[model samples]
Target chain A: MPTQRDGTPVSVLARQLRILDTFDAGTVFLSLSEIAERSGLPMTTTHRLVAELVEERMLERLPDRSYQLGLRLWELAARTPRAMGLREIAAPMVQFVQGQVRQHTQLGVEGGYDVVYLDRASAPNAVVNATIVGGRISLGASAIGHVLLSDKPRAFLAKIVEAGIRRYTDKTPQTLDELVDVVDRVRELGYSVADGFIHPAARGMAAPIYGPDGRVLAGLGMVVPSGEPVNMRIVELLRSAARRVSQQMRAAYIDPDHPHALPGAKFRVLINSSKSSMEYFEGNEGG
Target chain B: MPTQRDGTPVSVLARQLRILDTFDAGTVFLSLSEIAERSGLPMTTTHRLVAELVEERMLERLPDRSYQLGLRLWELAARTPRAMGLREIAAPMVQFVQGQVRQHTQLGVEGGYDVVYLDRASAPNAVVNATIVGGRISLGASAIGHVLLSDKPRAFLAKIVEAGIRRYTDKTPQTLDELVDVVDRVRELGYSVADGFIHPAARGMAAPIYGPDGRVLAGLGMVVPSGEPVNMRIVELLRSAARRVSQQMRAAYIDPDHPHALPGAKFRVLINSSKSSMEYFEGNEGG
Candidate 1:
């Protein structure tokens, strides 16, 4: 739906973008004909566009003539302050939590109707979870997704429900009423629990991470074996970690003038303060 | 420079790409005017191009209107089959090695006169190495860089020497003769080691990984404390680990028809195999 300077429809740009979008968690690379078929463009058009993109280094052509995303894209994405900044601060804390639990720990942000994982860490023996960095899952089927959904406006939630929920597994809550009850529980308990929803053998616990204005900017979660029942102990640990991470995020608000802030210093401050806060709160709250 | 079909001189695309290239390990994010200055383009042209890129989701506008890379780019880069495929097979192995070494583990590919890091994992207590995922380093500087450079032609190495190398620290090899000798050593030993070259307090050892055809595909490395010398014992561990990871990569390559065989799977395989191979070999090798 793009237009050129002469007011003509720039279908080429749209087709090129469509070809790029055809790649996701499920489809990461494609043959030239596969791209042509997926984008519904003529073979010639797809070839030309793919060639132009490759020339610009926006896409890379392998030895097999198939196309994959280019380093240019990765270099560009590294500039996104939200993904880079948030992940930089949250990674050490996530690593610490993963070290203790010896499970999968992830940091995600709500994107439309799903939660997109930005960073993830896992121990070698950790339970298998289908989620990967840059992978997305439905809001109604993931603990991080539910935590994000619980923080949104009621009108938004209503629209999401009306759009229909996907049943990834039998544990996925399908009805609007069920989703509402789950959201309410998440708000009251300060966390969300998903049991075998996205994956049949995985359960997840998640809490919301806030930015400077206390807006629910991202969600932090842990994936464990489904055979282990969800317990208050795990929930409390997640909440405490989320709170500490959020507080650190609030402190390091990337001043415009100081664009080159020391990322390591920021991470150290977050981890140190978070550890101290966890100890102090553990003794005081006894949750 | 790029030309249009009508023979019109169109450096617009090239100029726009230069703006993107300005972002490297040293500069991840930049202000509007800074981009213009670095790209050597007029402010008006830079502004318009940046706007178009932002609209296309190639760049993201921060809360303060400063620009960073976008997730769209990350998603696109995630599709690069060659880099992603190798990383996918190697990540598990890399993670296992990281767990045992409790240091930094990285996977890199040769790019022009530099080595581009595809994936990296570091312990919270690990020595701070000025490298990030998607970042690049000079081929003649670090251990990984040297390993990657060992695969390059002699003319390329001479060109780099003639261009003059920037000395990062006192320990960095400044003379062309010294650099040539080090690269020769790397090719002979099948690995490279650098103490206090890039960073004064870190010692890094890297081994080149080969593909099914025995072509040097990527380099896997470990960065440990400099106080602990990188003796023959450490070098053997890295070489053996790289060899095992290369074997796993060969096994994964036979199935090109696999859906995830694209960028995502490729990346995961490289990272996973590298991590796992390191762990498997580390225990048996007794470093």
Candidate 2:
């Protein structure tokens, strides 16, 4: 029922995309009727468009005659250059964190008002992590979300604030001021901690991971059991891991297009400052 | 120029997909005219479709006004259930292979005639692996490809053979009969070895990983240097890792709809036999 300008029906392409948008994490397999209902398009149009989509391999007909997103679409997304560089470089760091912490370690980036996880490495007995690779979580409900949103524009922050929050747990930020306060602290401390913000017995922590350009490329973090206080040692470990990944990102991104400016040069300032925090943490080891 | 069976023009959906198909790993960004040329569509139609695609976030306009695959496509692809289970469940096993072998470890599945890599973990100094995640490799040119195609139907195999071969190196199988022999060997030996098939100095090895249904789900593999012969120890490592991944895939895939068929039961037969191979290796370690 999405209308176009001048009160006309939406374009054919728009109508088609609506069908694709209907299939989500939960509704991976859907019948033709279900797709029509979710898309809010008529059955005739839905059937025609879906037939075309299947022909294009954008959607695959399942064994039970339902539909799921096709491997062709996944193949196309797999070749995206920006995602390739960030994910390939950050994967080992996330793997290391998963090994050492024995928890659910994830890497994510800002995607509008949510944190879109790019990659995750989970331990065998890890706590439930609501965010999966390619999945998103609201900025107010995730530690990674806080890390991703910390460096965004004030207007962008204001816009999401006006949208109203949907609280998942008692610890989730429920107001604009509360959300901004956490992001401000994340900026100041260069990390975020959210205890039971999504699941009541899970604690999540995150730190900003920068690209070669020293921009906040993604958030690297882990989810742990909330039986004890959040571990400061793990937070330090996460930051150090993020720092190493950022360095590797910088090293790999020396674009021949911009030969004079080294990607790692700008990040040195942050690294130097982080060393002071490392020293401070070392001094307070017993705390 | 794809046409309908009646010799009429294909649908608008097919035309739009042609534009997306034009942008592969080599051609990530293209000018409007380039898109039109590649899609073999009228310039006006290409322009209109690209505009709608940009609006839909299936295709993004670059800063320089060229087009690239949008992040929205990646998000949708990320939620694909089959890829989700395979990548998430198989990642840790791939990571372990990367650590032990100090080489490129990858997971792949048969996509039509080609093997499509699901996920990979690479060592910094590993031999070059041309097939990346979401990228495709011919069944004739990869160890993983052999592992993936071994259990498929004869018609499926015949269709790929009829599609013709594109050789990358001298070691690559050039005839359908040669391809079949290798796949048969892979089936009998419970593993595959393709030395310098894709690249002159690289040795690729693979083993099948089964789904919870005990069907051949994917191929877990690694690429190492072809120096000093293909090491038996690394092959053992790869098979064990694949076996472990198959177990995890089984443990996680218990759907009631699939009752009466014990998940991974057929694969357990492989695992039990593989243990004897492990013992054989342990006995021959001094060799």
Candidate 3:
């Protein structure tokens, strides 16, 4: 593959993306030196790429001269229909769950062997968890993962299982067989519970959210203290919230005039109120 | 500007970004032809680029072979600290205000000549709004804009004013002088109220959120029926919420062990319970 002047194993577009990939949940602001080191590019190459990104407003300068992801990138993240829409629809319900459960209530979707949390309401001073909005964790270590795994094809599940599962705690599903059995249970029950799978003290249960096509689109999970007994009421809460979100998701894919929308699913959450006055951002498009 | 192979006045990286930008809140899914048309790129170029983007998982292929913003992009968005953090900290309070006011309550930051909404809790089926998350609106048309404008330097305000304020309704500020007085009044009272500015039937009030350094960071605004009198209680609610978010914003920028977190500002909102197991996403970096 043709590479940048720095001789990275990709195109210039790939090189620029590598520079952006250096940032994650843990690392936000970075100096040029830090960027170069993390991206494994020469300082001169990093400098040029950083300058382009900054000019395009995909990355911005902090007061101290470090760089952080810019407002423009976040805005694109905002305009994203599925992820942002799902979060909006699930927001009120997530907050309600967090209030009742008082631990961590989250909405997540499957991405490869991990489940990506889309939105969450964190209860104050809760037990350690492995999930947050915009954060992802291994499917082998949480109820949400099991819920997502349940809907996957047997072949896909077998492939990931063959790849191997890393145990997060002593109780996390460690072997391929264990993962397969857990998936079966989740598929049967329409919910999954993983006690101390992520953190030793945290226990969680997740219910699958179905789209209008009746395909599992996401998972709604609640995490609490493992010492507490399994709360059936919370399980019911998860199912109800997931049902509402699922109905909403299906409607987004269907036309407003389409009669095929599930009869009970009212898109009451989606009423987008804006015509989007984004003339200021029409320019400076950068990858 | 080194152009793409098609002789467009931009780099290949820019072309790729334009492709991504084509999918916004309104346009989530598009066919190859639609992507080419919307991005203003040639058919062959769009075809080759779309294939590459799908390969990289930046754009996902729907079952019908149309493309939509993929999960990877949402995951990238999740790692963004500023936008994500601000939304997380302000989520609870936004819901609170929405519950009390039963209106569109939102958080916005000034971006160029407009205020970009960060997060919002829209009251069910509320009045028409001119902005949404990831959406922006003119500084002369709403209370949030006034609060954001209030803290801008005199020169910056003058430029937007000179550029011409487009009136959304007859009541929207149209002149530089009216804009100036609105800013002055907002500064004096530490809040702003606009009656039927953006929509004929909507009124709004906003308060500025300050940073640890006391710089205005964002605005918290609530929109209600234009006929309703200005509610002083909502103003009080906004100030307290803004104050809490301001303190949290300062803490994010401060050291973990720093003794000076303003006498009473604890990072109570940010006690995210996640250990963040994003290691699965750690390095299959694709451009």
Candidate 4:
């Protein structure tokens, strides 16, 4: 994407987006110079655009004259159907599950070859987890990620396997054969478990959330410190929660006002209940 | 901007965004007709674009053929600096407080005339709250919203007040003068208390978090049932957390790598933490 100083193929809107994208989980704010450098725009252009954006409230200038993502973007993004809708429905249920298990609970959706966390909740004293809400993990690495992968066609899985898995820890399954086995287990048991894979000290149990047509929509999982003997109790809890969520989804499907319904389709997928599906799936799967 | 049937001001990108924006805390998915109607685009265009977007994996089509915000946008937005970075720094602190308080804990930043929730953790059995993570609330309404307003100049407050306060419940403060008093008290107490303002059965306590220059960067709050008396212990915990966050902001400010520091500014205001100053000034003027 690099180009001669002024000949960059980047559109003005893309450049502006690039400037915004420069901020991420690691970097929340940046100086004008830093933004210019990261966006690879002329310092003058970056300054002018940044000023305009700030004026539009798309960027906020800190007391020190540093810039961060404007609340406007967040507000606009809040209107995004997928993130906010799923979050609203899943939140209370996630809270319920976290309360019961006192562990790190997360809701993730499949995106390409990875799983992106949309919502995550844990007790203050819960185990530390590598996944953060609004963060992504490889589909081959974490149990939740792999559960999403397992729901996809085998051809898709092969494509992902072809793309090397970056090992986060020694326990991350590196070989394609091992990954295939894991995927099979996820499909067979209707859940997946990763012990000390993503983070050396963390273990996770995850299951798929299905849409009305029985397609996997997302994955829900819980993380805890490693070395806890695998127990049926946790599995049962997660499965029950997942089942409850699925029922809610089915209810939404039958509701005439439900947005997911097609013009004449008999049901809606009910994205909101996906969290409950996660909980229910985990609970039943564990049992 | 509307145009003749032959030509429309709405660009392909804007239409694409509209499809995504149509999904919110309430609307998660929609059929082609709903998409076209809500976005004000023709069915042909909506169908074509939605199909293309689905191909790009930027939108997902369910078995019923309705569309939801594709995981792609969530993935990309996840990389957006504001959502990820602020949450990372704030999560641990929020988690700690939630552990101690066992109530609804939230982090929010001002977005235009509203507050965009970044992260929230609540006691599973805590009071039902209207606030949702990644949702928006009017600036003149909630405790967090007012905390942000407390940092703005008087002229800015006047503009907002003139714009009008959306009353969500009977207890919601309507007049600007009344709101000014609320802001004053928030400043005096180093925090804010919202009683049945946003939702009838809910109340909240919030404190501002500062950036490097001691400006209010964000607001952290908790929600509880309305009838329950204000818990001083939770207030103390929130205040302490806000203070420690302010210290972190200061450290970031002094560091050369801090985003807000200009090359050589003699004085800097932390944008997110200046609520105290604004509140103090307002109180002195008999706000």
Among these predictions, the greatest TM-score belongs to 3
Instruction: For model 4 chain A, give the 10-residue run with minimal summed lDDT.
Output: A278-287
User: Candidate 4's error at A25, in angstroms?
Assistant: 2.8
**Cα misplacement distance, residue B256 of candidate 1 (Å):** 4.1
lDDT of 3 by residue, B1-287 (tens): 46757667476667788888887655666789988988888899899888877776677887777787777677776766657777787788888888887778999987778888888776545776666678778877779889988877878778887777777778878877778888899989999989888767778889888866677878989877788778889889988888888876775664545443211222322334432322212222220
lDDT of 2 by residue, B45-93 (tens): 8899898888878888867777777888888887666675577777777
Expressed as tens digits, the lDDT of each residue in B1-287 for candidate 1 is 46567443264455556766655433445789877877777789789878877777767776666566666666565455556556655665666676677778888887667778776766656775756666667888878888878877778788777766668688787777888898999989788888888767778789989887778888999887787645676677777778988897777553456643434234333233223322333333211
Q: Comparing to the true complex, what docking class would candidate 4 get? A: incorrect
Residue A141 local lDDT, model 3: 71
The local lDDT score (0 to 100) that residue A56 gets in candidate 4 is 54
Question: Candidate 4's residue-wise lDDT over B5-83, tens digit each?
Answer: 7554344445555666665544566788988887777789778778766765567887777766665555555544545
Go through the candidates in order and give each one's C-alpha lDDT: 0.70, 0.73, 0.74, 0.68
Of the candidates numbered 2 and 4, which has the greater lDDT value? 2
Q: In terms of TM-score, how similar is model 4 to the real structure?
A: 0.69
Candidate 1 vs candidate 3, lDDT winner: 3
Q: Which ten residues in a row have the lowest lDDT in candidate 3 chain A?
A: A278-287
Report DockQ per prediction, comma-separated. 0.23, 0.20, 0.35, 0.16
User: What is the TM-score (0 to 1) of chain A in model 3?
Assistant: 0.85
